[model samples]
Target: MPIDHFHKFLTSAQQEEITLEAAHARLTHFAGRPWLFFPEFSAYVTSFVNAMRNPVAVAPVDASLPLSQYFIKSSHNTYLTGNQFSSKSSIDAYILPLLAGCRSVEIDVLDYKNEPYVYHGYTFTSRIPFKLVLQVIRKYAFVTSDFPLTLSLETHCKAPQQIKMAQYMRDVLGELLVTESLDAEVMDLPSPEQLSRRILIKNKAAAAHDPNSTRPLPDAERHHSAQSSSDGTNSSMPEAKGGPSSSILSKKVKFVSDLAQLNVYHQGSRLPKLPRSSDSPDLGPFQPHFDQIFSLPENKLASYQNDFDRLVRITSTNIIRTFPKYTRVFSGNYNPLSFWAVGSQMVALNYQSFDFHTQMNQALFHPGNRAGYLLKPD
Candidate 1:
């Protein structure tokens, strides 16, 4: 019961979880139920903590399947460290997640000072210089693990800035950026092993119509092809996007044209229905404002159980990303295990907060050497 020993134990706990062997040895003097006096420094590390540290068993992960075959860790508004709006955007948004082994990170790229910046659009969110953010990413892209990083950018920049976005990425990322998979003709996603240490960009492709075509492609036609979860490769570069909405579409066209020439791998776009289980490149679902519509996991399980089954089916095969509900104004996070139970891969968590969901996420990826990607159960 010495104060000095307690202080040392606390200090060590801050750096890493204490091992049970260390705890048992330290509390060897205690006759019985050592945890009663020192609950925090229990003689035994709980089974939960042990399981978190080592998740896999005799069944090793199958790495031969395509990249889309597993659950991909993702982030939604990765730049903002605060709420839906009026929050300060910082490089930490990207840092914390990448450090926690999150594979997919989002960037809200906008036009500012004749250069590109990142922030949530239509909100009072503060902007951070796009170059600086990318610089931070380049520096820490592989700090936690040596796996590929997915940049899920939401571009609101003009054509010039869009081109700059591409150029900056090419310069900053260098060979770490992946433009194509080894076998592009297969149409299915490549294995994570195949895309190790690469960076994947997910942004809506530029629409081809002049924004006033008499017979523009319909909503169905725009997304006719099932875009790969890892997304469309040159798989013959199918025509892209939805019916005309605004002049912005045309501007996007100008930029996507530039990207197409560059041979970008994953073209982000609006997907129609949930993709069925497959090895082919199919569009994955990302349902933003999920909690508002369905509330928490319990409510959804009670009211929309059938839909939950559908989710399990979809996620069992493809990676689906469900973001925090807009109602969580204080940057709160949900228990990601519920979604994981249904097989959703990238349950984009609010890593800024250490909520239960974030803890589960950290634990789930904690096993397997923190490589950031985990295979969904068969």
Candidate 2:
């Protein structure tokens, strides 16, 4: 038989095995026979031997679905069952229902300096270290067999504390740690440098009002530098225009400009660490005293003053429209019980929260929909 036909027959045969010894005898017997003209059966036999010696393991990627549906809100107490490190059974009992619906879990971690613990406040009564909780989770939590379930870790430690304890656990167990909490009003990512610059600008503006800080410029009055054009609008808003001498009064105007920029934010940023008094009316717009800064051409001064006035008006309008959302969430005047009750009902209904979790999940799994969320400055 041709080698091709014989190979095909071997493949088609069911439960038929030719031992190595028997196969070698058959090959030897066939060798040098006139009917078999094959010269390189050795290579074929070697290929077969290698194929039989080593086989690869194949796993299907499509066998599983993502566990994104499972999530935990950090405000309330929630726990996972049968976590490798968590040994608690009762906490897992409370967490079982949430686990069935979701693949990830969350818990709040407050710092306990020397030990792996969880707590809040200055009192010992509030302490609940993570070490104790994980011990129970590992004991009773039923982790998904195929997919690694994530523990959504949240830290409530103060900003200055650089304790590496939690980071250590996150590294070893490969869980997600959410260090920053989203505020009622969304703000840009915290950058210490940006914060410092803003503080410096505010300080400089305050210092300009001090006689001892810097001498008043010698020439506060000067001829109008900005000439009125056919349109009659001062073009100096974006650049230096006819005001007091650009050299002398420019520094003072710039200082005021920096102060105005720093104070441009809504109540929260502008205020000196206090809630707005209920009786006080909103300041309508920024009012920079142009008369102090410049003696401009009549038409040009009006135009420049109007530009400054309009910018403040627009900014305040934006704040008035958007600042309420944050006030509701952050004002602490909210009744916690009422908020909790509503949230509980929504969770019972499996209603998705339109904010953080939804956005975060979308960002992680559905990258295409990621975008920004902004609210007026608080």
Candidate 3:
């Protein structure tokens, strides 16, 4: 390096060090931990702090790789601001996650007043007009991020209602709706680059029943759900559409094919119902109980060595979503690291909570770059 260039580099390094030190002071000042800082620390901490500001790339991330090979920030039950029972729901719920750079947000849709509503089904959780939620999504979808966003839809709508949802989604999302040719590769999910500023729906289209219909939300949980809905029309557990627990998968509604076509880029499932193939949709990192039931005792990721290895291998080539347990009625989240350790791409957290899980999520995605997708380890 030339002498002048070397001097300039030193000056730049010093400036960066000053900036980081000031940031440290500001953080501690707010935290009321000024005693934690000392003058001597600056000499040694500058190099380390500067390195942290520019972390080494964990994996090669560009336009070539498929979408499955990435860790994505995600949120579960995105609408409910409170507990499962008497909590409130709002369009702002959609805004919160999207603003925080969540690549995927879930919306529980049901037929209400001949139109679609978004909320927790069979529970007292509040309901917001689906169109209202769509508006929030449309406005905030690309503001914080230009990468693709997936809406995890759990539908309990009739045929006409489903069509209404389709039309409304198209209208609200407008040009952001990805109709076709989202991925460059034929056999894989598209890279984030391919679907920038696009929104993809994820659902088992035509499902008329709610999965937890038989198991009503307990009174406490129902109360929260009901409180979320201002009108309190569904204060009591609404009579389930289907009598038996034949499961939502079997309850076929109208517009199944139409809705499926709209979900071109992504699809969500609670289990590996479809065969293991490139065409198969992304199966869930199901809630603990659901995972235990579907994955089996020895096949569970943490309990079985082979299963953990299998998760890593599968996620390397396929997109997988792991969500928190449904029993967490308090809007709590799961330890995201465990899921990430198994190569889970979308460790869906309850963004409403400020728990350990949320902290981890912030740290992982804190690096500036509005791209919502994070490259998973190779």
lDDT of 2 at 374: 13
Question: Model 3, which residues run further than 4 Å from truth?
Answer: 1-63, 183-185, 205-255, 273-305
- Stretches of candidate 1 exceeding 4 Å from the true structure: 1-61, 208-254, 260-265, 273-318
lDDT of 3 by residue, 161-203 (tens): 8778888988888898886654335655777887778898765
Using all chains and alpha carbons, the TM-scores for the candidates as numbered come to: 0.66, 0.24, 0.65
Q: Which ten residues in a row have the lowest lDDT in candidate 2?
A: 196-205
- Candidates 2 and 3, the one with greater TM-score: 3
In candidate 1, list every pair of residues with a backbone clash.
67-190, 188-279, 188-280, 203-268, 204-268, 227-282, 228-231, 228-281, 228-282
**TM-score for candidate 2, residues paired by index:** 0.24
Instruction: Report lDDT (CA) for all predictions.
Output: 0.57, 0.27, 0.59
Write model 1 residue lDDT over 19-87, tens digit each, in one string: 655655544433122332332233123222224354454344456675555677776678887776678
Candidate 2 stretches greater than 4 Å from native = 1-76, 79-101, 119-126, 138-145, 158-162, 167-378
TM-score comparison, 1 vs 2, better candidate: 1
Ranking by lDDT: 3, 1, 2
Candidate 2 residue-wise lDDT, 1-378, digit = tens: 454444443455523365545544544443322122221232233222224443333232221211111111211224322221222323433233222222234443444665544431222224455655655444323321222222333333332221343344434333222222223243222222222111111011122332322222212111121122223422122122122322321222122221122221111111111123344333332222221111111232233332443323323322111111211211111122221221111111111122453333222322111011111122
Model 3 earns a TM-score of: 0.65
